[model samples]
Target: MDSAVGRCREIRLRAYPDGMIQPSDLTIIETALPEAGPNDLVVRNRWFRISISTRLMANPDAQAVEGIPFPALRPGDRLADGAIGEVMACPPGSGFEIGTFVSHPLGWRDYAVVDAGSCVALGRGPIEPAAYLGHGWTAYAALTRGIRIRRGDTVFVSSGAGAIGSMAGQIARRLGASRVIGSTSTPDKADWMTAELGYDAAILRNRGSIADQLKAAAPDGVDVFVDMVGGEQLAAAAEAAREGARFVLLGALTAELNVAGASIVAPVQLDSFQLILKDVTLRGYSADRDSAEAFPEWIAWQREARLHFACSTVAGLENAPGALHDACEGRLRGLVMVEV
Candidate 1:
């Protein structure tokens, strides 16, 4: 280990946000790295993901995030998420080599001492390390295991320009969907979704009624709906869904994480009679399910350049809180990452 690598800089919650997150809510501190255990690997974090969930976890009153066992955080607790890093040190039986890149759940710090069992080694590949931080597998699981998109199916993905939504649009096409449509918050994102992400059409959620816009975008109705932004979008999807449509509820960004005591509930005003008549199947996505089955296919597609990785990177770990705030506020596009 380098002499200068002894101390690690970590970000901890200084205070829980009252509503919207402010810079003062987070504080950075320097501490000595804990001695690596016999079965542990010392990793120097390179990149950490910032998502709406980051904001949710920061709220002390928020319910525990399903699938992720980590409890709701309080002041002075360290925040963690999906992070990619290089192994700086490893025990003899750890089955990993120094300089190897791996993905782990310990982030928001310059270094991590994690059990080797918790880290997934990223072997040498043509793809960049940052690409591994994408949410392709999440999208794949929803489209395949959750909804099972069929050939010629028309798929609608809410938050099309977001981390998972960006991948969902392209994966739906690769999975043989004839028409892939997406809904975004801005006209620019809508255009990008169509021009760059291969969406057959993009609906701008802010322009007017999402239900009206979605109905216009998919005039014939959507066969499968991958909804990340709930609320009006869910109702819109329901209204524009064809009979026997499969709907996967992923995230409820419309709930507004900045609001005090935010919960992950998407309050939709849908006609139960219409949903029943259409035979719409609605299922909530839980990350606890095995998504490993989608990894091989997702990697193969990435190797073939069939998927696009989109994100906004912020330099330095200290800026993560602000970046996270931006992500929660929908100010950043795609996957918001902090380069540590």
Candidate 2:
């Protein structure tokens, strides 16, 4: 019990360069127990979600995309990410108590000292914390803010089996989309998307041309596209887009391919004629900013919809590097989580 109540282990980035992330670039350091300040609470992290963009923050060659609020990390800085944790300590009137489940943006560590007001208590529920961290509010935000989901629209989601994509496919159908198609790299993922995730069609990205796959999946064209992997996928989306379609640009999982000299210029190139002639409306999405505005509605949706999200977890603090490496390399599917 004492071991669980005290000091914490943190993963710190030592150096960042382009290409694959090495375990050596990260170092684990032990520190004294984190003390909560006024209006602050200390949480013992239960899970941390590993994402591609979060790994890119540790890459020196990664250029920050405009309008994306990537936390600036220095060599000695603790890598910041999203995690679900339990409040271990809080101020007397903080409204949070020991064992109260909470979520925060500070991860890559065993403990988080987060502002009391900023922390959200998950309360007693069947909703798993890992699910909340992965696709809970983000799924709602993606549908509402990323693009207006009109009833009976044909929706296509890239990276369809991953956290956001999985949720997008289901949510679009719930919102009355006539057909929901997904793009995935593996045959297993494609099967999972169409079978388990309720996607109407699955386009295997590695099997052949993405454009060709999309064309076959939705011959009439997609009315909305939820893009999680930018690059050729984006171009493919444009090619398969219907006239007046809405394209929601969410994540650039492959943007590292364009990283050069501290700049990320035109990492994703879309066909101009397809976009122009189709009169496509492109919108960028940010869960962090959009979530705050939709928090109340998101909470309501969670209860009403009873949505479920799954994660593939890596155990222990030491294995965080391996999880991050897998995410950066596009080797992992769904939400890559770390259980502390």
Candidate 3:
């Protein structure tokens, strides 16, 4: 009989207090393989995986995250969120067939053993499956929730050229946003969004005050703000928001990363009580927390919503460290997927 062996890439946590992900924060341990138990299918290492919140990054009590339980991947860890590789073999009577590609929670490893119950077969799509994890779903979620982008309502998007941001802008237009104003830190990203991605208008954050830019960008005031990083931008969303506008606060990446940068920290003080008095609604969003039916409900609607995603893929399980570093540095966007 052939000896069964598996190579796995695992992330062991060290320590992180400032929310900055340091290289030493996670140790990648490669171990000898274990034979599949019971109905588990062993996927031959093809493309391991990379999701923004990798299983390791999400594991319970990740020091990098705020107030998480110790050892984050608790008994309730959701496997639907992870993706993996082609099946090398499945126990007889196991549902997965050899060569079938799968995405599951057993991530950060070259080879994964998934019970038939924990994984789902990938569906056919126009883009590569990696892109779906790296880019597709987050954008899918961002654009789907928020004030309706009806005709004549001006829309302002922070991180307009970012992984989820760029796709959100496109989807808003398709949903009938009259004017899509995108904000970026540099002219280069602004240009890319306009010249390449069909953006209606782009604003450079480096220019005059963000408030001024928004005023000029939307003389009528912005009806919606798709905010990914919520520091000053959250306050900016409040300032630039049209009366009764909705500010969708997503991830606070800027504040969470460079906590010292005043550009991100200062504005949140709120210029005055007039901001809240304006009747604007500011709500935070977490797409992962969904009702049982809600997941399928939106999944069905995305077909008509027409969302887009982008992914950066790295081959070989060992390259995950470099990939994570690139992602933390903003060199990579959307979802970073590693092929085990």
Q: Whose TM-score is greatest here?
A: 1
* Ranked candidates, highest TM-score first: 1, 2, 3
Give the TM-score comparing model 2 with the true structure, all chains together.
0.89
The digit string of per-residue lDDT tens for model 1 on 71-134 reads 6888999888888888898888767889878889888899999999999888543346545677
lDDT of each: 0.81, 0.76, 0.60
Residue 325 of model 3, lDDT score: 56
Give the clash total for candidate 1: 0
Model 2 residue runs over 4 Å out of place are 1-6, 61-69, 124-127, 257-263, 268-274, 306-308
Flag regions of model 3 displaced more than 4 Å: 1-4, 14-25, 45-81, 91-94, 123-127, 205-208, 259-267, 271-277, 291-308
lDDT of 1: 0.81
Give TM-scores for every candidate, taking all chains together and pairing residue i with residue i: 0.93, 0.89, 0.77
Q: How many clashes does the backbone of model 2 have?
A: 0
Kindly give the stretch of ten consecutive residues in candidate 3 with the minimal lDDT sum: 258-267
